[model samples]
Target: MQSNPGSPHSDLTLAARPGAARQARRHVARVLPGWGMAGLADTAELLASELVTNAVRATAALVAAAPGEDRPPVVPPDRLGTIRLRLSRPGGRLRIEVWDADGRPPVPRAADADAEGGRGLLLVAALSAGWGWHPARDGGKVVWCEPAGP
Candidate 1:
């Protein structure tokens, strides 16, 4: 991960674990304010959390479906692949991205009002200035969003 807060770009690689979402959120919380983008922090952190959570789940799902696994509650680090979070502010808009080994595009479903999950992408679209995904050069995909910034 890039350590220079002053730089326009920051990146973090995390194992595909349940905690990845929180770590990604914290990264946004730190980076945005460091870059003098505190106004974008709340939105960016939430968006980052959602994107990273999706990536972690997708990556873990792929691993669990592979041969010899009896569905462990939490994947061990040795068995877990990694997801990456890349943040940047270009042209004055904060962009958040999460990359994982799954190539499927994000599908936003019409979650029921009481549903505890499945609204990640919908929230991304509604709160962000723009959002999308693309095939990464090597493999998998990179899902990204830019929060509505002043």
Candidate 2:
């Protein structure tokens, strides 16, 4: 979560939890007030949901692997441990960035037409204007997408 020293639209971090998704939507709403973009809130909420859900699941796996004092829900405290949500309005797009504590990038699984699971990233691809991932210096990866223009 490195930020440009003087950039106002630099970086923001939010806890990774089920409820954090809703909080993220609220944050986006507050930040982009009067944007009047239809379905923007829903898109943001859905993206937040998918990303946070994945992060929580990954954290649980890490906790199970390392038995000791109850590890915090997020992992790799100084590195890949915390989930990071970065919202930026640099150009004509609303960028939603979700960072998780895993260096291995996420692969969007192809779901069968009749399948009930493995559709989160598919939804992300369908809704977002564009989406992709990048490796964080600290061994985690940031998956991000841009919403349709306002």
lDDT agreement with native, every candidate: 0.85, 0.65
Tens digits of per-residue lDDT for model 1 on 43-143?
A: 88899999999999888687767567544233345535999899998897889989887777778889999999999999999999999999887677899
**Backbone clashes per model, in order?**
0, 2
lDDT of 1 at 50: 93
RMSD of 1: 4.4
Residue-level lDDT of model 2, residues 1-150, one tens digit each, is: 333423334344655556666666666655544444344767776786676666655554654566675443343556444576776666646777877776566778888999986888888888888988987666667788886545
Evaluated at residue 72, the lDDT of candidate 2 is 36
Please give the TM-score that candidate 2 achieves against the real structure: 0.71
Best by TM-score: 1
